[model samples]
Target: MNLKRFCTRFREMRTCYVGTQVSFLDKIFYVVDYVGAFIVHGASISDYFAYGFYKLRYNGRKEYITYRRYHIIQDKCNVLSNRCLCREKNKFNELFKNFLGRAWIDVNDVTEEQFILFCNQHPILFVKETNGYRGIGTRKIETKKQDVKQIYADLVSDKGAHYIVEEQISQIQDLAEFHPWSINTIRIVTIYDTLNDQVHIMNARLRMGNKKNSVDNFHFEGIGANINIETGIIDTVGYDTHNNTYITHPLTGKQVIGFKIPYWEDCKSFVVKVAKNIPTVRYIGWDIVIQEGGNFVLIEGNDNADHDFQQLHNCGLWKQYKSIIKYF
Candidate 1:
């Protein structure tokens, strides 16, 4: 890491510490989190020992010493990230555009494919919650030809549940080459690797949901499977789009494979490139859309992402994560 550049970034974020300092000690905690590099580099003997409990738990969990493990090691690692939930959508959007360039379609106000009113409108639009998690309140609505009066009324009558619909992403599907329900997405996790102070692609999973399958929220029962970074093929773990057992596809009835994710490398690269630009976010999960024909689209990004799929895949990276909580 370049000390000068890190220092510059650290100083810019320090402005966040300007207000609400009742006293010096109170201010110290606030600044430590905001400017982590300084605290880690210049920690005193007491400060270093303060982190001993966290390090022990995190490191012990990673070592696989279930034979005789201590109680406190896991607690320390769990405290590493400080669980900052304030992912500013505008900040993310700006960072996303910086890396994705024109490839990202902007959806300020409109409707997308799922919500299109008329079949005549072949291509539709879509927008999920800027901060939406788990496919909640996701709508495939047609905004253009809607009776504007009724939609406007909904704002007043409904509980201000706002949504956006843009044109549906269109891509040619190769029937012979691809399977049905092909609107699959790749989930790539990037970690700051606090111990090494380097970024690592921690995990990759495939989230598949087609028009026939509906919503891709894993909690909403969407199928999720692990894919190899070296090769796009799925790992042994597989679940239905609705979080069901590996049953047949309702529309296609094709046997689902426990391990068969396509275009794995392309999806991982798309995420890694975008992540390299967002400097503060040490951890993230990028969702990439692989159209029917096999090209990739940067659908969206997620912070504070889940690790259940990693365990399911038997990839066993949880221990690895347990090993790297010191820096954050």
Candidate 2:
């Protein structure tokens, strides 16, 4: 809520919105959403008028401040609890141990010799931080690379580094055609139904990486589309991190809209099962990758899901999940 931070974030969000062609009407709606948040939280708008206003205000009623208060704090799920399950990618792999062929190892635990051996074991490997986000701390390591040792050292240097070595996931041919080199994944948002004691899929989106980035994160220079939850079909063309639009993929020229996600039912089932197992954290956003044969692998889970990504498509997640999330 610092004044400087608020001004900075306001400028950033406004800039992104303007670049994306967000209209005057939409901007006015953003103001209304901000006022609603201010009144609901029972705090002076000026107190949060800075960074908190810009960061959490516009997405939905259950945005930054509301999300932290209701989904996280009110649920008694602290930062440590969220990280133990969501932030660490390896924890998810272990949590769903039955899903075979997907493996991950921490660089700190393995010796230099073992690291090289692990690299050789897989044709293509993904080096990642156990607690990274936005695909910032990830690298693709090919076995053919000669400088594996130096790369390993740099990843595990004394600056107190933490890294995980994971196997590369292949997408189904149809999905891969959109972005072959990157592992395109489906991001499904879910909330636990306290009343019914069940988990439900609230909404879904498709994230496809461009040729420049290795991972498919919407905020990491990748393209994303809103998904039709019932039909498993992409509802729109992909948009980039900066809100730049794309109808045909820049690299492949493959049509982005109307693409159906394979193994949609199985993916939903797996996520529900996973959510049920982790009962303490009721809110979740899962990143699932569909394999070559349509079987999906769990990439990771997010407790504080980004509400803005859904809003980028000009739809609000809170509107879609109002009944399910109202109990929170």
Which lDDT tens digits does candidate 1 get at residues 1-328?
4878755543443332232334767546544542342233332222222222123333432433121121122343233443232143434555565533222222333344322343235333344454556767555545465544454345334444443333455433422122343345568877654555566777777665534544665666566666666776665545642233454434455444544555556556666667665545556777766665566666556665654444442433545665564445
Evaluate residue 220 in candidate 2 and report its C-alpha lDDT on the 0 to 100 scale: 78
Count the clashes in each prediction. Answer: 30, 2
Highest TM-score: which candidate?
Answer: 2
Q: Roughly what TM-score does model 2 have, to 2 decimal places? A: 0.80
- Candidate 1 C-alpha error for residue 239, in Å: 1.6
Candidate 2 local lDDT, 1-328, one digit each (tens): 7978865665566666444576778667656655566677532333233224445544433433334343433244323455567767667667756653477787878999998888788888888887788888788888776578997888888466578888877778887888877888889977776558787787789889897577888777788888888988888778865557888899999888888788888878877877776666677778888877667777877876765565555453444455555555
Go through the candidates in order and give each one's C-alpha lDDT: 0.48, 0.70
List TM-scores for all candidates, in order: 0.58, 0.80
